[model samples]
Structures are given as C-alpha cells and as structure tokens.
Target: MQPLTAYCMRGHRQVEGWLQRGSLSILWSLLEAQRLHALAGDVAEIGVFHGKLFIALALSLTNEERAVAVDLFEMKRAPDFEQEFRSNLEQFSVPMDRVDIRRCASEMIALSAAPEIFGSNVRLFSVDGSHEYAAVIHDLNLARACISQVGIIALDDLFSAWSPGVSEAAIDFLRHPDNRDIVPLAISAAHGPLITGASKLFMVHASQVDFYASELMRMNRQSFKTRASFCGVKTLVFDFTNGVRKRIEFR
Candidate 1:
C-alpha cells in the first residue's frame, strides 16, 4: 500500500464508510477545538468499518495518546473487514502499536472494564457500532463512562432514514436521569439541496457545551447557521456552503 503523511477530507473519502461529507468538517472542527483547549486523552470509535473514520482519529493523536477501535469485523458481507481495517491504517501512516483493536461485539464489552479499556479521558468517542436501539444505548453508556470532562461524543445515524433506531436510542440516553450532565452541542443538518437529513449529533459534558458551541460558530462563520432545542438544550445546526462544499469534494 502507498504511504500517507497527512490526514484530510480528501484522503478520508478514499476509505469506505457511511460518514457524510459534511460530518467530516464537523469532526475536524471538534478535534481541532479539543486541541486548542488543551484537552488530552485517547480517541475511540465503536464501529470501525474498514477504518474510514478511524484512520482520521488515529492520525490526530499526539505524544503517548492512543486510539481504541471496537468492531465485530466478521461481517456477513465482508468477512475480511478486519484485514482491510489494519491495511488502511498502515496506508495512512498510523503505527500499529498506537491502536488497540478489539474484535468483539459492542455488547460483549463489560461496562466495568471501560476504565481499563478506554481510560477515563477519552477526548473524542464515536458511537457507530450498532444502529439498533439497544445496541446504541449500550455503546453510548460505555462512551459516557469513558469520556473526559470536556470530551465530545459523536453519535452517528441520528437522522438517517436507514437507522431510525439510532435516533430513538439517543433520546433514551439524553432522558435518563443519570445522563443529565451530557448535552447536545451540535447537530449536522441539511442546509440546501446538496445536504439532506441530520447525519450526526455531537454531545459534550454540560460544562463544555458553551466552549464547543462558540468555537464551532467561530470556525464555521462562512456556513449557514441556526439553532433548535434538542434534549432540553439549544444545539448549533449548520451546513457547508457551496464554496466550502466544493473544497471537500473528492478529487
């Protein structure tokens, strides 16, 4: 495989995944803001299909930081998904030792093992493991247990037509009395004909909501912006403009 030295939206598209183009910008903005705020921790993703988004998260790591990837790579359609995932990491210049790969179902992971497996300071945790309501809730609870004080959780398929269960699970998580500290920071939505449906919901500990929301607004000044009440908190909703969208188009 060819070597890659840097990570970009262009490079990320080359890897196969369901992540929307606009979501890439939002993830990058969150990661960048985390760095500016000096939040230090590991990054993890539950469903790492072919390492598409995982590769980007791994490349963002610094110093002793690591990335934990959880997935049942033995897919019925792609039996060799595990091999493909590792190959993509190598192609993207991510060191093998920097990643801790767990080949198991998300539900199989014990909540008690969260601290040892994910550590308590996971700065960014992506929950795309299973779209089923039960699985989504389980994965999200695991994320909450491992997330840092200011960490951001990226919950995927919240508004995807193919996965209505994911959205329902999100509501269940936010409504729980135990999850009162977690709040929606932003939601990716369709701004025009190019974008459609909200693809992801970004949540942060209540303490850092303002920080991330303001930072996102400052970074995305050129894009359309609006807000809506979600899970008892106002969330920043925006999409890329024609010019910004053109820049991320796969070449």
Candidate 2:
C-alpha cells in the first residue's frame, strides 16, 4: 500500500470538496480492487459537491462505464456549486459523454425514475446527500436497489457530531430485515484535526466480507501498519502514518 499521497494528492488538490485524502484513497482502492476482480458496473454519488469525489470516480471509470452524479445543483444551498463542479471536471479533462449529471434532490431521484436513469450495475455508491435520517434511509434503499452483486456503498459523515442523524439512520437501515444483506466491510477516516478522523464507512453484501477484507489489506499494505484481532469476529485495522486509521471488521 504505497501512501495514497501520489494517487490521491493531485485530485484532492485539484478538486475543492469535503472528501479527505484518506477516504479518497479507500475509494480508489476499492474501485481498483473491484476492477482487478473483473467486477462490471458503473459508479455514482448522492451528494456530488463540486465534483471532488465525483471527478475521482469519473477518472476511474472505463469507456463503457458511466459516472452518475445526483445533487440539487441550482435549487439548493450552493448556487455556484454546479458551475464549480463543471469547471473542475473540465479542468481535469473528465469525459462529459460518460458523466450523467442529475440536478435534483437525491430523495426525489430515488423515488422517481432512478431505476431507468441508473441501471442496476452500480459498483460504488457514495451516500453524502442530506444527512437527515429519512434522506439517508431513502438513499440507502436506493443504493440497495441499484448496486450490483459485488458493489460497495460508502456512507459519509457517519457518527459525526454535526450530523448525528446519519448514524441513527444508517443503524436503522442496517437493522431492518429487508436490508440484512447489506453489511459494513471497512471504515475510513478524514484528514486533518478540525474534524473527527472517522468519516466514511464502506459496506458490501454479507457474503462478500472475506473478499473485500482481503483485497483491501493486500492493496493497502504499504501505506498502513496492519494488524488482525479476534474479538469474537475477525477485525483488521490499518493505521496510517498520518494518524488516519481504517478498521475492517468481519461482523
């Protein structure tokens, strides 16, 4: 696991958004690993603020794959956000033909024509839209419906003080009988001290736990000091030099 500095630094600096290097590294690793396993699917993000993480996803996509971005571009808080997002995408030379931009609230998109708009082959789904409990639940349900067999969903701002509802909603979804198949595979933190380190939690189908854990460990061996623990369930912790640690628990 070479420090994500080389892979993530350029995108992190070029795009102005909330995702930290550590979490971005994890996202890149997951996508790369999935590709290695010959997984076939597209990528998407619920809240594509300024296309920071969105651009990274776009760059990882194949010519046949699409990167869908859902957000309330002109209607919501950041009026100029959409402009900035396009500008950044253009600056990075992202292929507009393969990018699908939906300028609407995530809940609306989830309820309406999401299935037709986004096929059922989503490989990586990022949930960073409205942090409200109901919104999170809706987005999770949408992800469940659209994701592929080996797809991974990355939930942002989990357990953060600013949005306690995200944690509550995620727990609710996880506990629901209908969503039992979705389980947490790995957890990554944000960079810097201003925010709490832990920021994102990646999930996958219950059956693919071993594969996700092994692939993550193999790909990140250089950047993190890895250790395994058997506290009822197998747990792998990757402690990075920058103090951003990722824990993958087999629950």
Candidate 3:
C-alpha cells in the first residue's frame, strides 16, 4: 500500500474554480500518490472539466508518463464556462509541457480503437464525464479495457447523482460476483467537497475494500454521527464495485 501524499496548501487553491470543483483531481492525486507503485503507463481524465483534474494528474506525474485530458470544453451550460476553467488551470501551479489536453473523449478513445488502448497499458483513469447510467457504463467499459495492471480508476459523483440511473449503474457494477476481484478503499471522507450541506455515503474500490467496507460505512453512516460537529444529512455513492461482475452475468 503506497501513501497518497498529504497536500497542505497555505492559501486556497482554486482548482475547483476552474471546473465545478472537479474533486476527482483530489482522488486521482491520492491514488497516484498512494496505491500505484510500478511505473504507470498513461494517465487520463474522462470528464476533463476545464482540465482541473487533468492538470493535477499531469503535474503529479514525472515527465516520462503521458497525461491526457479529454472533455467537450464546449461550454455545457453556457458558452464561456469552459474558458473560465482553462483560465483557472493556467493560474494554478501545474506543469503544462507534460500534459496533453484533448478536445473530447471520443477523440482520445478513437486513438486505440483499432489495437486496444490497454495494449499500451493505462496507469490512472478518472471519470467525471457524465453521471448518467449509459455514460458511466460506457466509461467503465473504456476504463476497464484500457487500464493496466496495478492501475487505479476513479469515478466522480458515484455517491450522489442528479439521476437515479447513476446509482443504478453503480449498484449493478458492484453486486456483480465477477467483480469480487477488485476491492474498495475507504475514502468517502474525501467526499466532503462535493456534498454542500449533507453527510453522505459513497463507495471506494481497492484490494482491501471488502475488509474496509464495514469501517468505511461506519465513517459515512448516518446513524453513527456522534461527533459534536457532525450533522446527520444526505449521502452519496462512491465505489461499490466489489463483488459485482458475477451479478451482471447472472442477470
């Protein structure tokens, strides 16, 4: 088990200001700093919200490792939001030369469609593109297909989604028995930034997730908030993918 380096910033870093606070950046950095040991092959961000997590992962890797940032960048709700995200990344302290920010996910996936993306070995993957069921499932297939051994993949908004399909996709992913191989890691405490005013539940997958599931649920469980500062409220999903693949086969 590697250590996710503890980052302590004196002043506020506005990586979030760049793209709706893409918390996947924090999770990816933690995974890179923590789990991944052998040299990683490639680092990718599926959502690529203005390059926040992309820049963070890019800055995290050594020059030799390739970092790919993919997003629509077309201003989802408005025409100028993506630029603001870009501006925020520019203002932050990130290494640009080591990073390659792609225009879209389809474009990046297109590169390896012929020979398999994993033939090159994917090291780190962060998915924040769409919380919808179909989108998440598509991203999951892509990530699983591309990721190499000892690779770490993270999905944004796994806990709380605007739509039920997100959680449904997640539940289906986890309950699968073939998924017994992958495990969960307890990191729901990190979900604080995403949920504005609620104590939520989420999942994390790792080699030890099965062992840690009880402890993690305890940490995020609504019933056990005895801390004086704790407030019982809403919860979200994280990485309940362990023991899931078989469930898919059964149905």
Best by TM-score: 1
Model 3 poorest ten-residue lDDT run: 242-251
Model 2 steric clash total: 2
What is the Å distance of residue 195 in model 3 from its true position?
Answer: 6.4
lDDT of each: 0.81, 0.74, 0.47
**Across residues 153-239, which tens digit of lDDT does each residue of candidate 3 receive?**
665554464555655665566555655444333233222344331112223335533433443343334422222211121222333
Better of 1 and 3 by lDDT: 1
- lDDT tens digits, residues 1-251, model 1? 12222355468767877666577677877777766667789999999998877887887788899999999997777776888899889888897798999999999988999879988899999998878999999999999999999888999877666788998999989989999999999987633332232468999989998888887877665664678898889888766555343122111
| Cα lDDT tens digits for candidate 2, 1-251 | 22222336564676656777677777877877776677878989998888878887777677599989998865355555788888878877788899998888887764456667777899888988888999999998888888888988989986588889988987788778887788877766445652523568788887887998888876666555444332223434444556543333222
How well does candidate 2 score on lDDT at residue 102? Answer: 88
Write out the backbone clash pairs for model 1.
Answer: none
RMSD in order of candidates: 4.0, 5.0, 10.3
* Alpha-carbon deviation at 109 in model 3, angstroms: 3.8
